[model samples]
Structure formats: structure tokens, C-alpha cells
Target: MANHKSAMKRNRQNVVRRERNRSNRSRLKTLYRRIDEAIVANSPEQARQALQNAVPMIAKAVNQGVLHRNTAARKISRLTRRVNAFAQNS
Candidate 1:
């Protein structure tokens, strides 16, 4: 219940941003799952491709303020490491 006009406008903006962020997060999760599945299935090429696709999206999420820069970096680092390890092992 935003009584003030400005508050109401801000609330509306918040709702839009919340939904946008939610979708972005869901997409990221899907990408992560794809990578994880590829890893578990021992498909190096598929895992690498999924990691490649996810990195830029993660960065974009950081740029869009949906994720912190450090958080994005950490995620990218972990995914890359896992993919690299799987590649080396296979």
C-alpha cells in the first residue's frame, strides 16, 4: 500500500525489476544445470559449450545489477574449473 504518488511509482518499478531479476536468475540456474548434467554425463564438449554460453550471461547479469561482480566472477571461476577438470580427466 503505497499512498504517496512517488512511492506508488517506485513500487511499480520495483515489481518490474523483481520479475526481471527472477527470470534472469531462473535462466542462470537452467544454464548451471545444463553444465552440471553435461559434467555428470561425462560429456566434455557439451560441458564446455554450456560453460561458454553461461559465462557471458552471468556477466550480463552482473552488468544488469542482478548479480554482484564478485559473485559472477566466483560462479564463472567455479564452472570453468569444473569443466576444465572434466576435460582433463576425460
Candidate 2:
């Protein structure tokens, strides 16, 4: 319960931000899954494209403060490695 007017406003802002962050996270998950599915299907081109699309969105998440810089870097690194390995093997 936010009794103060400013506190109430802050709470409202938090709710909005929370929903936005959740949506961003959900989108990230979907992007990740797309890459994984492409890899599993052994479609190197699709996997590469998915990685290309995902990298920018991941960076955007970091820029938006939805994800930490290090976390974003780790995710990009892992996904890149997976895609590269899959491409090389295929």
C-alpha cells in the first residue's frame, strides 16, 4: 500500500516497467528457442539467421537495462559458439 502520492506514482511506474521487462524476457526466450529449434533441425542457414536476429535483440535488452552486460555477453557467446559448431558440423 503506497500512502504517499509520490510512492503511489513510483509503484505505478514499477508495475509498468515490470510488465515491459517481462515481455522483453519472454521475447528473448522465444528468440532463443527459435535458434535452438533451428539447430536441432540441422538447418545451418536458419540457425545462423536466428542467431543474427537474436544478437541484436539481446544487445537491445542490455541497452534497455533489462539484462546485465555480462549476462548478455555470455548469452551471445554461447549462442554464437553453438551456431558456429552446428554450422561447421553440418
Candidate 3:
């Protein structure tokens, strides 16, 4: 219901941004799940590799404004901790 031209343009932009953010978030969740699965499988090497891949993806998400820097840092921290713990155990 955006009547003004500028408002219509803004609405269009919002739709695009929403989709982009959703895709990024979905990708992040997938990456998190992969790391979790690797950890549960008790493969430290695989978990480590997944974490290595995830960290940069997470940073990119933060850079793209899909995720906050603190949130990204927190996720990276927890994932790294889990991977490190797995390494210590195995």
C-alpha cells in the first residue's frame, strides 16, 4: 500500500533485502548444523574443517549486515569451543 513513488521504491528494496537476509541466515544455520553433526560424529578433523569454513562465512554475514558483529563473534566463539573440546577429547 505504498502510494508515494519513493515509498514504493523503498518497499521494493525492503523485499529484496529481506530475501537476501533470509538466504544468508539459512546458510548460516546449515553451516551450524554441519558443525554440530561433525561434532556428534566425533570427528575432530571434520569438525575443525567445518568450523574453519564457517568462521569466514559468518564474518561475511556480519560484513553484509545480515548478522551483528557481536552475534557473529558469539557464534564463532561457541563453535570454536565445541571444536576445540572435541579435539581435546579425541
Candidate 4:
């Protein structure tokens, strides 16, 4: 148990921070999923749009210390390549 008022306050702050981080991570993951789905569906237009929107979101998460920059770059790279191929084919 938190023995003092300051410790109790710290506990509350930690809880709030954890929830916020979870939400932010969840949002990033959801966008990533959407982009992947569009790519697999071979919809060039949708994939491009999703990549346009997701790029900054992924970068922002990395900037916020939620994701590593290399990880974000790898995801962006693969998604872009997939969408570009779709565009070329269609």
C-alpha cells in the first residue's frame, strides 16, 4: 500500500499515464492494421490514403517514445512498397 499521500498521488498519476499510453499504442496499431488490410485487398487508392495518414501517426508515436524509430521506418517501408506495387499493377 502507498503509505503516504504523495505516494498515493503518484499511484494515481501512474495509472493515468498507463491508460493514456495504452490508448495511444492501440490507435497506432489500428491504423497499421488498416493499411495492411488495404494493401492485401490490392486497393491502391485506399492503401495510399492509409499510408499518407498513418506515416505521421507512426512517426508521432515514435517521437512520443511509444515506438522505436527503426520499427516505424520498417513498417512504413514495407507498406509503401506494397502499395506502390499495387499502383503499378492497377
After superposition on all CA atoms, what RMSD does each candidate show versus the true structure? Answer: 0.6, 0.4, 0.6, 1.7
lDDT of 4 by residue, 1-90 (tens): 898999999999989989988999999889989888987887888989998999999889898878898998998898788778888998
Give one digit per residue, the lDDT tens place, for model 3 in 1-90.
Answer: 999999999999999999999999999999999999998898999999999999999999999999999999999998899899889989
Best lDDT among the predictions, by candidate number: 2
lDDT per residue for candidate 2 within 1-90, as digits (tens), equals 999999999999999999999999999999999999999998999999999999999999999999999999999999999999999999
Best-fitting candidate, scored by TM-score: 2
Pairs that clash in candidate 4: none
TM-scores for all candidates: the values are 0.97, 0.99, 0.97, 0.82
Comparing 1 with 4 on lDDT, the higher-scoring candidate is: 1
C-alpha lDDT of candidate 4 relative to the true structure: 0.88
**Candidate 1 per-residue lDDT over residues 1-90, each given as its tens digit:** 999999999999999999999999999999999999999998999999999999999999999999999999999999999899999999
The residue-level lDDT of candidate 4 at 1 comes to: 82
Q: lDDT of all predictions, in order shown?
A: 0.97, 0.98, 0.95, 0.88
**For model 1, what is the C-alpha lDDT against the true structure?**
0.97
